[model samples]
Target: MAPPLMTVIGAGDIAAEIDRHRPELTEVVRAAYLVHDAGDSSNPHSSFLRFPHRDRSRIISLPAYLGGEFEVAGNKWIASFPDNTRRGLPRASATLILNDCATGYPFACLESSIVSATRTAASAVLGAQTLLGTRRARRVGIVGTGLIARHVWRFLRELGWEIGGFRLFDLDPAAADRFGAAIGSAAGAADAEIVVADRVEDAFTDCDLVLLTTVAGEPHVHDPCLLAHHPVVLHLSLRDLAPELILAAQNFTDDVDHAVRERTSLHLTEQRTGNRDFIDGTLGDLLRGRRRRDPGRPAVFSPFGLGVLDLAVGQWVHDRVVAAGRGHRESGFFTGAED
Candidate 1:
C-alpha cells in the first residue's frame, strides 16, 4: 500500500483559500528571513508540460523553506507566457504544493496565482505599515492595473485607507478602468474615488504613496523628482524604477540576496551603476527590529516575491480544506519499490 494521492485545486478555489487564510499568511511573511543570492544565472527557471489544447509553453517550479511560527516548506509551479494575454488568459498561472515537515509526505496541492498575488500585496501592505507609519495617506498612485494591482488594491483597502482618491494609470486604458471599478466597489466606508490618468506622471502628482507595478523593463517612467516629494513609494516589481531613483531613496528589500538573484530592474540598475550600498536593509531585518527607519529619506520597498510566502499560505489553505473535508483522497496512488 502507498500514500494516497490528493485532490488538485483550480485557480478559483485557490484564490478563495488564500483570502480566507490571509491574516495567518501575513504573520508568516513577517517572520521568514530572506534567501541568499547566488547571482542571476544561478536563479531557477520553470519547467514545461505541454497540452495541445492550449499550445503549451512553460511552467515554473519555485521552492523555499520558511522557519517561524508555521515551520513548513513547499514549492510553486507557475505556467506562464506573454502570449496568454491574447486569449484572455493570465500571463502567469500557478499551482502550489505544501509538504508535511516531519515525514516529508505530500500534503496538499492548491491554486497559487491568487496566493502569489495576495502574498505580494500583503508584503507591500506590511512595508507600508512599517515605512509609512500611521500617517493617513491622502492619495495613492498605482502604475499598473493587472492582477498584481488588483490584490494590492484589496490589501490597501484592508488597511483602512481611503480608496476614493486613488489615481490609476496603466498602459491599457481598459485595465485602469477595470481596476478602479473593482476597487471602488470593494472599498467599504472609505470614500473611494478612482481617477484615470492620461500619463504616468499625472498619476504621481501630489500622491503621498506611489506603487509601481509595470513590466516596462526600464526605470525611465519613474521620475525620482516625482517621488522625492512623496512620503513613501512601494516598488513591488523589481525593475520598475531607475537606478538613480534607487540610489537616491532609502531602499529596502524583502531579501537582499533574492533581490539581486532575481535581477529585477532595481538589481540591474545597481549593477549598471556599480553601486550596491544603495540598498539600506532587508524587510525581514526591519520587521525583526534589526533595522530602523530613516525619517529624513524617502522609503522604497522592493520585494522579489519569495517561495516561502507561497509555502506558508499554501499550508494554511491546505489545513483549512482538510478540516472541511473538501479534497478527495485517491488511495494507493504511489507504490513503494521492493527492498
Candidate 2:
C-alpha cells in the first residue's frame, strides 16, 4: 500500500525480531551459504573507508544480492572504532538498507549490527559443531571479550553446546571480569566456568575451540606452533594470527575472494605462499558435503561476513515484524509526481 511505505526498524526492535526467530536464524544462514556456494548470490568484496588519521577506525560497506527462494538485495554499513570501548561504547554498529530490486527503492532500514554479529556468531558456532562433530566444545578460549564474544557465548549455549570451560583474554581485565559475570549469570552450570586468562597464550594453551575476535591490524601470534593443540579456530576478527598459522591450518571461509582481500591472515598466507591452493573451500562447501576436514591439522575458519547475509537477515527481520504489524512505517518518503 502507498508504494509499500518505507519502514524503520530500530536496534531494540531488530533484537526482538531476532529473539523471536533465533532458532530459524541458523537455518536461514545455512540456506544463504548454500546459495552462495552454488554461485546464486552476488557478494562483492567489502569496501572499507579508512581514515589516514584515525587508523584504528573505519566504516565498511557490504553490498550484495541473494537469488533464490528468499531473493532480496541490501547493503550493510557498519563502523568499528577500537577506542569506543574505553568510553563504554560498542566497538561496532551498523544499519541495513533493504531495497526493492525491481524499482531500486529502499523499502526498509534496519539496525543491523545485531544481525551482522549474530550471523557471524552463528557461522562460527555452526562451523565448530559441524567440523568437530559435536555440539559441545571441551574448552573454549576467546582472545577478545567484547560484544562479539558475548554474542558467541550466548549462541553456543542456545545451541545446547556445553562449554566445559571458557578462558577469556582482553587487554582490559575489567572487561574480562564483566564478561565472566555475564556468563556466570547466563550459564555457569558449575562446568561452565569463565576464567580470565592473564596471558593471551593461556587462552590458547589447552582448548578445543579458540576464537580470535580482536581489533588488530596485522599479525602477532607468530609461533604458529602455539596452535599446536590444533583446536578449531573461529577466526572472526580476520587479522589476528600470522601467516604461518594460517598455512598450518585447514582453512575454510564464507567467500574465498572477499576473505582473501582484507589483509586477513589468509591474505597474508597467500602473500607468503604465492598461491591459493591452501584454501580448503568454504563453510558452504563443508555443509554441502563438497569438502571434508582432516583432524591432523588445525582447522581455521575465516568468514568474510558477506552482505548477502545481511540482506537475508534484514529481509527476514522486516518480514517477521511487518507480518506482526510492527516496524515504523512512513509513506511519502519521496516528494515526486508521476507525469
Candidate 3:
C-alpha cells in the first residue's frame, strides 16, 4: 500500500498558467455549469463566518463534489476584509483543498485567490458571451475597479473581444483612475478609448455591456431607468442592484437557490416580491437551450459563486501544474497507509 502524494501549488505558478489559458478557462467554467446542472455535483450553500463587530468582513466556505469527468471533491475557504485595502493588501484571499473522490483523501492544496478570481472572471466572460450572443461590443462599462474587475477585463481582452471603448466608475475616484490607466496601457486596448466616469449612471449609459463588481453590501442603484440601453449586465459582485431593477430585468443566475440567499440583490428582490417568478433561469438552462434570452428586456446574470466551479478549475490547475513538474509534492503526507 502507498500513501497518496499531496502537492502544494503556490500563487505564482497558478497565475502564470492561468494567464496563458484565460479563454480555455471559460470553457472549463461552462463545462462545470453543465455538469452541475445535470445533477452530477453537490454544492452546498456557502457558510459565512462573520466577526461580531466587523460587519463588512467575512470568511466563507464553499464545499463541493464534482462528479462526471471531473471526479473530485474540494472546498474553497476565502476571506474578504474591506479594510484590507487601507493596509495595502488585497481585500480577498483564499486556499483550496482538493480530495480524490475514490479514496476521499486530500491530494492537493493550492493558493486559491488566483483560482477564485480566475473562475469568477471566466464565468463572467462566458455569461457575457452567452447572453449577449456576440464576441464584440461597441462600448463596455465597468462599475468597480478591483481585482475581479481587472481579471474580467483581462479575460475579455485575452479572449479577443472587440470593444470600441471602456467607461469605468468606482466609489473611489483613484481606483477608477488606476483601472482606466491599466486599460489604457494594456496591449490590445491602445485603440480603445478609456474614460473615468463621473457618475455611476455614466457606466450604464449607451453601453451594450455592463459589469457590476462593487463591494456594496445592499442595493443602492434604485433607478431602473439606468438600464434603458438594455445591456447584458454581469452582476458579478451580487449585491449592487435594487429589487425593482432586478424585477424589471430578465434575470439569470448560476443557481436560483444559492443566489436567492445571503441578502443578495436577488434575494432581496425575492423577499419583496414573495415569489421566484422574476428569475428567468439558471446559466445552465441558457446553455442547454431550456431558456432563451428576451431581447426586448434588459439581461442580468447573477452568479452565487458556485463551489463546484472552484473545484473544477482548481483540479484542472493542479493537474496542469503536476504535469509540468511545478508544484511541490510531499510523499508521506498521509502516514497511516504504512501501518
Candidate 4:
C-alpha cells in the first residue's frame, strides 16, 4: 500500500492562486460561516501561548473540523509579534496543516501567513457587506495600515466595491503615507482620494464603512462620537474599541462564545456590563434573516478568527495547487512510520 502523500505549498504559489480566485474565495468563506452556524463544524476555543517575558508576543493554535462540503480537519499555528514590525517584518506569521478525516493523517503543509490574512480579510469584507446592505461607500476609513489592512483593502477593491475615498490612520505617520501611496497606485482606486488622518478618531468620522485593524493589545478607541455616522465597522483586530464604544454600538460577531473570550473588546464589554445582551447576534443570523441590523447605531462586526475558515481556504488552495501541478510533494513523508 502507498503512504499518504504530503504536499508543501509556498507563499508565492498561494498568493498567485488566491489572486486568481478572489471572488470564489470570498464565497468559500461565506459558505464556511454558514456551515459553522448550522452546527456542522467543530471549532474549539483557540489556545494562546503567551511568553512571560515578551508580554506582547504570542502564538495561537486554532483546531477545527468542518463536516459539510469540506469534510476536512486542520489546525493553524500562528504567531503574532507586534515588535516584528519595528524590525521591518510583518507582525504575524502562520502555517496551516490539513488532515484527512478518514485516516487522520496530515496530507499538506502550507505557508499560511497569506492564508491567514486572506481568510481574515475575506471574513471582514463579508461582514461589512452583510451589515452595510450595500457595496458602495462614499468614503471609507481604515484604522491600521498593516499587511492585514492591505489585504482587506485588496479584497474590497477586487470584489467590485465602489469606494470613493479612503482615510487612513496609523500610529506611524510614515506607514499611513506608504499605505496611501499604495492605494493611490492600485488598479481600481486611481480616482479615489487618500488622506492620512491625524487621529484615530478621524478614521471613523464621516465614513460609511470603517475597518479597525490595529495591533493594540488593549482598548485605545473610546470615543463613541466618532461613530456618529453609523458606519459598518469591521473590527478585525478585535481588541481596539473600548467597552463604552462596544456597548454603544450594534454588535455582531462570527461566534458569540469565541468572541466573548480572550479579553477581546466584546469580553471587556461583557465584564463591564455583566451580561451578553450587548451582542445582537452572529453574522450568520444576519445572513440567514434571523436578525436584522439596526440602522440607528454603528454596527460593529468582530470575528474571532475561526479555524474552520482556515481549513476551508487552505484545502481549496491545496487542491488547486495539486490540480495545477504546482507545489512540492514529499512521496516518502509517511513511509514505515510503524518502525
In candidate 3, residue 331 scores what lDDT? 93
Off by over 4 Å in 2: 337-339
TM-score of every model versus the real structure: 0.86, 0.96, 0.98, 0.98
Q: lDDT of all the models against the reference?
A: 0.71, 0.85, 0.93, 0.93
lDDT of 2 by residue, 1-339 (tens): 246589999888888877736558878888888888888988878889999999899999999999886778888999999888779898888899998887777899999889898888878888887778788778889898887887887778777777788898998899889888887777444558678999888888789899888888898788887778888999999998898888888999888988998688889889888999989989988998999888888899998888888887888889988899988988877537462
Clashes of 4: 0
Q: Which ranges in model 3 have alpha carbons more than 4 Å from their true place?
A: 336-339
Model 4 lDDT-worst window of ten:
223-232
lDDT per residue, candidate 4, 53-131, as tens digits?
9999999999999989999999999999989987989888999999999989999999999999999999999998888
**Deviating ranges (above 4 Å) for candidate 4:** none
Q: lDDT tens digits, residues 139-178, model 3?
A: 9999999999999999999999999998999999999999
lDDT of 3 at 60: 99
lDDT of model 1 at position 109? 76
* CA RMSD of all predictions: 4.4, 1.6, 1.2, 1.0
Off by over 4 Å in 1: 1-7, 33-59, 187-190, 336-339
* Backbone clashes in model 1, listed as residue pairs: 46-60, 163-192, 164-192, 164-193, 239-265
